[model samples]
Target: MTLLSLSGVSFAYAAGKTVLHGIDLAVRDGGNLGIVGESGSGKTTLLKLLLGLERASAGTVSFRGAPLDARDRGFMLGFRRSVQAVFQDPYSSLDPRQRVSDIVAEPLRSLKIGTDIAEAVAQALRDVDLPPDAAGRYPHEFSGGQRQRIAIARAIVARPALIVADEVVSALDLTTRTRIIDLMRALSTRTTFVVVSHDIALVALLCERLVVLEKGRIVEEGATREILARPSHPYTQRLLASTPRMPARG
Candidate 1:
């Protein structure tokens, strides 16, 4: 079943400069997809369109066969409730003033989800491998990896069907990156993931399929393993050649 789809979608800024052009993509329910491209490749713009932060200039963006119309409050609310996001820069994404429990419970509270907010927060923390006591602390108290875990905890606390992750591990060091990737991998078994990253190696570990974008267009797309092994596009081949291989796990 298709959870989200973009058909001939296009976007342009007020200056009339196009950022994305006639893009077509679909993400199935429980699918794991990666969008990869260098800077100025419309990767982030595509995400913005998916999130409804920006409207498509032409064509359609749909969720579960219905058009994404922000004016329709019911549809907008349902879409927001079903989809969650995790971004890069754990330090900045979280509020230093808010306790971890409150941070994780924000969505539940704002969305008026469960009646037992405390239980939801605790379970979320546990799911991310953090101790129960850790919820009382502020974001500054945790290390970078731990903070990202908290972010992940908050994202999944609502049991969202889809999670959009944008450069989620780019700020961390090698060891921390690996641990976070492993956490996401474990979560992907139950959640659909749309990962956007310039790090091909990291995306390869988390996604089964990939969409390679260039200058506002999809240049290549296929199974992750196939593209990695036999890239047909020059741009994709360049990406593969430039990405440093991750060291083998012991």
Candidate 2:
């Protein structure tokens, strides 16, 4: 079953520059997919299109076979509640003025879910393995890793069915990155994820399927093992070659 799909989607900037051209992609329900390419490969633009943050220049974006449109108000609201996102910069994505609890509760409050905001906030913090007392602190009070964890907590508190993690771990340290990746995998039991990144090796480690984009189009896609072991496209090979190998451990 396809949970989210982009069929013949295309998008262009106001300057008349095309970013994505005739792209087609589908993510199976509960599957983890990684979209990888160099900068300016239209990966982020594709994410925006998926989120409906930007409209498609052509073609259609459907969620569970239903087209996302204003007429589908109830469906759009449900979809928004079901599909969440965690962006690249945790520090910037969070509001500096808001306390951790408030930040996590914003969605619940906005959506008028009628749940106890305090309890929902507490549960979200606990799910992310954050200390209960941690909720009282502001975003400035936490380290980079902790901040990213807070971001993750906020994304999951809504109990979203699908998550678009756009380079969520790109700026973290190796240890922190590994922990977040593991957290993401654990979270996948409840939600599907679309992880977009430039690091082929990291994507290989975290995702089951890989889609390699080049100049706004998909050049290669396959099982992670197949693409990593035997890349067919020159662009895919270049990305593989450019990826640094991890040091061997004794």
Candidate 3:
């Protein structure tokens, strides 16, 4: 089932300054999708549209086959509960002052899930490989990778059907980044993942499908391995060439 879709979506900062153009995309259930693009390739704009932060200028952004209605409180509430996000900056994404348990339980409180909140938060922490005691500590006490794990824990605490991650590993060191990626790879089986990043190699490791965006337009898209093995678009080829070693299916 397609959980989210954008049909002929176009966006512009102003009348003439368009960022995205005539894009058609769908995020299916239980699959990982990567939206690959360089800086200023309208990646952030598209992310905003996907997250309902911005509406498309010329097309429809649909959730479960219906056009998005942000004004409809009931629909939005359900949408928020079903879909969650983990953002780019781990340091800033988490509130330094909030305890880890409180941070992870934000979705549960907001979504009003009636289950045992403490148990849910604890399970989320365990899912990310963080110890039980980690919950009492603050975000400042953990390393960058651990903080990102907390962020992931928070995102999955609600058991949302889909998780949208925007450059989640970009802020971590090399060793930390690999660990986070491994965590994400493990979690990908638990829920749908939509990973947006400029790093094609990272996407290759995590996403089974790929959508290459250039100048606000989709230039190439296919199975991740097929695209990496033989890229048809110049922009995609450039992206692979620029990557130190594009990840390939073995």
The CA root-mean-square deviation of candidate 1, after full C-alpha superposition on the true structure, stands at 1.8
Q: lDDT (0-100) at residue 222 of candidate 3?
A: 88
- The parts of candidate 3 lying over 4 Å away from their true place are none
lDDT of 3 by residue, 76-173 (tens): 98889889999999999999889999999999998888889999999999999999999899999999999999999999999988999999999999
lDDT of 1 at 138: 96
Q: List TM-scores for all candidates, in order.
A: 0.97, 0.95, 0.97
Please report the TM-score between candidate 3 and the true structure: 0.97
- lDDT value, candidate 3, whole model: 0.93
Off by over 4 Å in 1: 246-250
**Local error of candidate 1 at 127, Å?**
0.8
**What value does the lDDT take at residue 23 in candidate 3?**
95
lDDT of 2 by residue, 173-207 (tens): 99999898878888888889999999887777667
Cα misplacement distance, residue 236 of candidate 3 (Å): 0.4
lDDT of 1 by residue, 33-117 (tens): 9999999999999999988898999999999999999999888888988889999999999999999999999999887786688
lDDT for each candidate structure: 0.91, 0.87, 0.93
